[model samples]
Target: MPRTSTAVIARAKGAPVELATIVVPDPGPGEAVVRVQACGVCHTDLHYREGGIGEDFPYLLGHEAAGVVEEVGPGVTDVAVDDYVVLNWRAVCGQCRACRRGRPWYCFATHNATQRMALADGDPQAGTELSPALGIGAFTEFTLVAAGQCTKVDPAAKPEVAGLLGCGVMAGLGAAINTGGVTRGDSVAVIGCGGVGAAAIAGARLAGANRIIAVDLDDRKLATAQELGATHTVNGRDQDVVAAVQALTDGHGADVVIDAVGRPETWQQAFYARDLAGIVVLVGVPTPEMRIPDIPLLDVFGRGGALKSSWYGDCLPSRDFPLLIDLYLQGRLPLEAFVTETIGIGDVEAAFAKMHGGDVLRSVVTL
Candidate 1:
């Protein structure tokens, strides 16, 4: 049977998201229908609404989500009905080149529900087929997704907190742990103390890094970074980032420097603020038009280390999701802190304004 769900939808670019009824069909082969528990409001949703990601005008927003499997389609054995799960957009296809090469984290082909959720009749956007943002469109009561997209987790995990591991939170943690490979006793400096940067700091701390430096313009974010285990904080606007990072590390520079801000200038800072043969991780996203300028080509050769771009923190959902939740449950990872406030589905638009103003870590939509 088909179900009509109330979802936050963007009908056109720059338009306010509306509460609309979305028609979700019963799971088809290899798919599952999930009853959403909580969904986090993310900048990507705002990006979609602003036409920053694409012209998918009729966009069904919200991807960071956790839910329970209400029904499973034929041949779906990965998860069963009544299972508590965190939704992931990356359901890797086993046969892809990346997966076959043993780097499933870089899997080229990912899974999504084959059927589109249609806008219900009577709405102004009726008859429109929505493109679920990042293929999870979970800002609704019920969502249909590929069976593999649901990663089962501890039922005790709070839905509001667990949902974040589906996206930005995962991205940040992976940036430090998986991508940067922060190890015990290493010196790490994370530039940009937003959610992702703060998570990177947490990841570094979790890895036992002796000195974790956090750099951001906002004092509030720096404070949050300190709570997440940053040993030192740098207000980028008031300090010379490279010089301050070098001074903090006894003039040797940090062993690994992570750029959570995507701009070329910050990336340049990350490039220079590392010890010789040290790693530099770029996890922040940049606009298409932005490009790196004024960096000397010789510097790349003179300074030898891995320059990496962390796509979704190079995470393998099946392995990382459960482990992170377990760590969160053990009180090692402060997953709850990432959720700044809880709001209804309709509050997402206002949440976007807050995000734009750098006022909240995350404003979640509790179902």
Candidate 2:
């Protein structure tokens, strides 16, 4: 039977989010229903509200979430009822080329629930279909997702902290550890000290990088990066970004430079801020109008190292989430430091405002 759940929705582009009734149908084959405990307010949610993602007028906001699996549909074996889980957008299809080739993290065909949740009968927009942000639409009391989207983690970890692994934090950590390949004794420079950049710093530390240089325009974000394990800081506004990064690494440049800001300028900075034969990883999202940086062809040929873009940090949720939660439980990872504050569902709009002011890392919605 279909059930009603309260959710946050953006009815039109550039409009504020609204708390409304949504219909959450029973999990169909290969699906599951999650009772959300907490969801994080991310910049991507803001993008959805602004219609930056698409023309999909009604969007179900929120994706970074942790929850308990309340029900599983036929053929769903990945998670069971009452299991603590973190929801991910990419649910790899085992038969895809990437999966068969043993790189399921790059699975080209990800899955989402087939049935669309709609506005309930009372609303003027009743029966209107909602496009779930990133295909996991979680800013609701209960959410329906592909069964594979539920990655089981230790229940002992607080939902507010563990849920972060569902998106931005994972992107940052994976950008460093998985994509940038920051290893023992390597020097790393992460541009943009937002939530994702800070997580990259933490990841570099976790991966045993000797020096983690955090670059950002904001001092407050840099301070947060330091707390997350940055060994050095570079204020882009105060000095030459490339020169500063090079100086921190004793002249050559960092072994791995990450462009977490994702603009052409920052990407160019990342391109030039790496040691010869070093890696450059782009984790930040760029606008559709943005184009490739106008770097000399000679430079691209001369530098001779990998240039990569990280999509969701190239992560395999089933493999990464559990390990990360364990690390958090052991006190090795300071996941708690990322949470700036907790708010209720009604306070999402204010949380969005706080994000714009750069005063908070994450304003979590706790149910």
Candidate 3:
């Protein structure tokens, strides 16, 4: 039998989300039902609300979440009932080409629960079919997801803080450690000091990068970036970012420049603010209309390094989430600082406003 639960839903584009009764199906084969303990408000969730992601209206919002496994479907053995886990959107299919090549992080076919949950009553609802945001909608009291989407972690950590490892935090950290290949003694520059960018700074520090530079238009966020272990901060509004980065790196430019802002302007800045043969990582989510303008082909040739776009920070959820949680437990990674506030499910709409105003790093919803 389907369980009735309350969830925040994006009923239509440009409209505020509504808390409604949503039906959550029982775990099907290879699936599990998670009783959400905490979920973070991410920009991607906002994008889904604004219809920037898809026409899938009435989307069951929220993805970065930590919860206890309430039940598991057939063939599920990695996790059991009552196990504490961080819900991940990318459930890798071991048989995909990327997985076969030993790069499951780039798995083309990620998995989600096979069954669909509809409105409990017979009446059809308005707006599109309630699409699960990133395949792991955790805003509800209980959510159905592929068993592989659940990555078991330490229960001792606060769910509000641990849940973040599911998305933005993981993305930023992996961009630096996995995609940018930041190493000891390397100079790293991260453009955009939001949660994702800040996480990149922490990841750089964790990876032993000697110098970490954080760039942002907001001073408050830049200050937060500093607290998270950024050695240098650049106000993008007031300075020539490329020049400032070069100055900080002994005039050659940073070894790696990550564009966490996702705009063409920042992408160009990241492109120019790196040392010769240095990597450029674009981790920000870009609007559909944005495109790269005319640029000399020779510049690309002259750059002489990889220009890569990191998807979920090139993260292999199964491998990274648990290790990150352990690091958090060991006090090596400051995951607690990411949580600005914890609110109830009803506060998500207001939280979105705070997010838009750049007032907080993250407003987590505790179920």
Candidate 4:
């Protein structure tokens, strides 16, 4: 029998999300139904609510989630029912061109559950089919997803903390370790001391980066960044970010500068804040209207470094999730610190306000 679940839904653009009764179908071929235990409230959910993502009205919002597999479709051999798992949005299809070229991390085609969950009336009440946010909507008791989307991990870890590996936390950490290639003794600077930025600091520390500079406009966030292993903190509001970063790194600039605040000004700062042959990793999502302004052609050439945009931190969910969870379990990674509060599903709207105010790291929804 199909399960009835309560989910937060954005019925229209610029509107507050409401709790709705969604009907989740049983697992189909290549699909599974997970009983969601905990889901994190992320910025993407706010983006979807504001119609920044698409006109996919009635979007089922919530993605960073950990759950237990209640049922699995035929031919699903890797995971069994009752297995604790972290739900990943990127379920790589091995036959995609990226995967075929031995770069599964850049898998071009990710899979989602084929069947659609809908209102019980069976009519298209919302005028169109509701799109699941990031293909794994978890603001409910149960969610349907591709079998490959479930990454099994140690059940001993708390769901609220472990689930974060499925999204933002993973993105930030991987941005430093995998994308930026922060090496031992390298100087790293991360702009924007949000959850992602703080995670990047932690990742740099784990990767053995000697000098980690964290920049933020808010002093509270900078303090949090410092606690997360940043060797230095720069107040973007009061100081010149690029100059401060250079001053901290023997005036040669940091070896790598990560722009965790996706804006024209921050991107410009990141471009000039790194050393020659260094990397600038842009993990922050930019608005549609935001664009880079005029820059001297000579500056681009003289920089002589890679300016890379990291999508989900170029992370392979299957490979990175478990490793991060293990790191968290062993007390090396401070995943618990990311959770500012545990909220209920109805508190998503309030969580968005806190996120906008930059008052919380993450408000996890515990089901």
For candidate 2, the per-residue lDDT at 127 reads: 96
Error of 1 at 95 (Å): 0.4
- Model 4, 292-331: lDDT tens digits are 8577889989989898999898998888988988888899
Off by over 4 Å in 3: 122-129
The global Cα lDDT (0 to 1) of model 3 is 0.92
- Candidate 1 per-residue lDDT over residues 180-206, each given as its tens digit: 999999999999988889889999999
Best model per lDDT: 2
Give candidate 3's root-mean-square deviation (CA, Å).
1.4
Candidate 2 Cα RMSD after full superposition onto the native fold (Å): 0.7
lDDT of the structure predicted as candidate 2: 0.94
Off by over 4 Å in 1: none
The CA lDDT of each predicted structure is 0.94, 0.94, 0.92, 0.91
Q: For residue 110, what is the lDDT in candidate 3?
A: 93
Estimate, for each residue in 1-367, the C-alpha lDDT of model 2 and write its tens digit: 8889999999999999999999999999999999999999999999999977897979999999999999999998879999999999999998989999999999999989998899999999999999999998899999999999999999999999999999999999999999988899999999998889989999999999999999999999999999999989999999999999999989999999999988999999999999999999999999899999888899989999999999999999999999999999999999999999999998998999999999999999998
Higher lDDT: candidate 2 or 3?
Answer: 2
Worst 10 residues of 4 by lDDT: 120-129
lDDT at position 165, candidate 4: 88
Worst 10 residues of 2 by lDDT: 50-59
